[model samples]
Target: MNPRTVLVLGASGLIGRFVTDDLRARGFRVVGAARSLAPAQTMSALDIELPILALDTAALKRFLGKHSVDIVVNCLGVLQDGPGSSTGAVHRDFVARLLQAVADSGRAVRLVHISIPGTADADRTAFATTKREAERLIAASGVPYAILRPGFVVAPSAYGGSAMLRALAACPLDLPETEMATPFQPVAVEDISATIAWLAARHIGDASVKAVAWDLMQLEPVTMAGVIKQFRHALGTAGWPLAAIPSFMLDLGAKIGDLASTLGWASPMRSTAIAELRRGVRGDPSAWIAATGIAPKTPAEGIGRHPATIQDKWFARLFLVKALIFASLVAFWIVSGFIALFVSYRAAAGILIAHDFPPAPVDPITIGTSLMDISIGLLIVFRRTAAVGLVAGIVASLGYMVGAAILTPDLWVEPLGALVKTGPAIVLMLVALLMLDNR
Candidate 1:
């Protein structure tokens, strides 16, 4: 008999990647689809780059028929609404269309949706409300469905909130006392995969698991502070004294994150994320554990299973610093232009005039270069155009260096070393470009 073929949407995500790999290893022919594929994912022939969200019901039906998929696992989700993301579109509309496509395809396809754990009253943010709506849609769609709500997913690869937690653990910092005390029950990624595998092993139209909604997480009570301390121990920084971060500072960071989101950056520290974090992760896992007979690992057991390598330490330390690096680069470019164009326009133009150049074009050249500098800074401020801006900044810096060497070679020996410092600035821009990818 041939193995069952499974299709995984959003296969490049943190949980989706692991689930795809795990299912394939267990003998299922897994087809992984994502909006964009990373360099590492290019090697997998089973992984296809696809914009599933944009597809209509008819198109999706064609896709399902083409793959002959027996099961569909939707791991696609966004932390909050941003420039390129819409919670309502992804969580509600997409699921509605998918349900229609599955029914229209005339295939016995089972949908295993990933959702959040919370009641209607706890749904303060759009992220939670939309997710809950998706679950409701799935239950009523007349399709074989299972909704698994995993709490505070802690996987080997970190992104968004998990990345933030690691950064906090690596540094000598902690959240405010009240925030730390919030309930934060965590679930291992392995347990999530195991539950899916168990469900797949059963017959497709099995009555036991039809239209089931289960919360997948450890039964032991854990708090945010406990989780962070476990991470600190894994990183060998448990003894480090942690300075409490002010609550106001967290709110300020969320506002800045919201601003960043408008520029196409999907920052995890947005107001929605803050509101959800404060609400805390709470759920009962007895039903899931009883059905699957799979025991979830506690925070200590999961985090301690593997020792932290140098790469782990480096990622944790650099997570928060990535924001600082971009902010500084933006400021550097804008301020340099502002100073030259407004503060000391005469001084800027005097260099060209003093270099024995024709007086006719000196002022225009000075003004054009200053405006170009400011333009690059503005481009870098938006996530969509950041790469173009960084590359342009590098080229412009080189042009200035070469032009100065030919025109005013004496400036290299100036007391401030202004001309000599352009080299480091160029290197910094290159660093920013390399670190731009969030996933």
Candidate 2:
């Protein structure tokens, strides 16, 4: 028989990308599916030559029918809730629709799904509820499926809580209070991919062992704060003292973050995420090892396998630096505008008058300029309009420098270098733009 054709959903995600590569290497014909073609082209580690299809239910069905797929591995998932999207829809509803499409086509496709280890059942939080619901849908869909529940998956490139851990490690801040430390069995992404590849290959022809739900976990579990210290050492950073905040505080912060997220902010610290953390991510790896005949590495071993690169170091340092730069830019403009309105109004009007702007319009000009500055700062604060805000900042900075040069040359040589300092201010704005791209 020809090699089994497998379609990997969420092919651009951290786990999905690795799973796609592993399946292809294991002599399976792999087709990667993602929400959009642009991210597939730019971010995915899947081969450029691999056939990438859309993730919509109808689109997936058409591709399956055309390709005669034997296995479908779903690596699709969301860490937090956002506008027009939620874990309920992305995790549960989408899979339900997918299973419905599969049943309608009458294809005997084996499904290998990735799920959270602790969330074997649904709960109140969106993360837990949708994950469990998806598992239920898979079980009831009549599609032969294998659910792989992984705990605290880690890779070279970090995101979500992993990134936060790295940040904590690289940070030099000292906290005065102690926080509750949760333990997790952090698994290697490679191990998860390997298990996924093995199951895809074996389940294609086997009817007896199809409906298995294995917990793919590490050999040992580590505390949350302890893991952060390990990652810090790996990044060549020294451990700093941390004050622990109560779990309830984390929940409250996450709740506030969720509200901000509705406005397009992508905070990993959502209430649902905090809830998941409190629940912990520990599971038995015995079943996975027996099924795949693969011995998974411990968390420390896994960390050693993927040695930190220069880029990892930069990411660790810049993650928080990016936020600082953004905040600084916002403050610079807003404070400058505030001062111009209250303290520098007369001086601002003098420039307009000296430049031959009508005297009657001088106050209006000053007020307009101050409002423009404050507005740009506010735009920079919100993620939805950050790009536009950065572009506007560049344009506004240039305009100010040119106008000041012609109209207020004396201010350039002032003791504070008020006009001359615009040069560095423009550069800072450029740096902020660069930091935003890192996201």
Instruction: Compose the digit string of candidate 1's lDDT tens values, residues 348-417.
Output: 9998888888998998898899999999999999988999999999999999999889889998898999
> What lDDT would candidate 1 get against the real structure?
0.91
Overall lDDT per candidate, in order of appearance: 0.91, 0.74
**lDDT tens digits by residue: candidate 2, 1-439:** 8988888887766787777766777788887777644443343343333323225667657777887888888887877767656777788878887887677766888888888876445366777778888999998877889998888877766766777667767776421123335667788888887877777667455865568888887666676755665676677765455555555666676786687577666666777777777777777888778767888777677774455788888888877667678778889888888889988888877767876777787888899989989989889888879878888888998998888778777766779877677888889888888766423
Model 1 residue runs over 4 Å out of place are none
Question: For each candidate, what TM-score against the reference?
Answer: 0.98, 0.87
Worst 10 contiguous positions by lDDT, candidate 2 = 45-54
Backbone atom clashes (below 3 Å) for every candidate: 0, 4
Off by over 4 Å in 2: 25-27, 37-57, 119-122, 173-180, 238-256, 305-307, 338-347, 354-356, 360-364
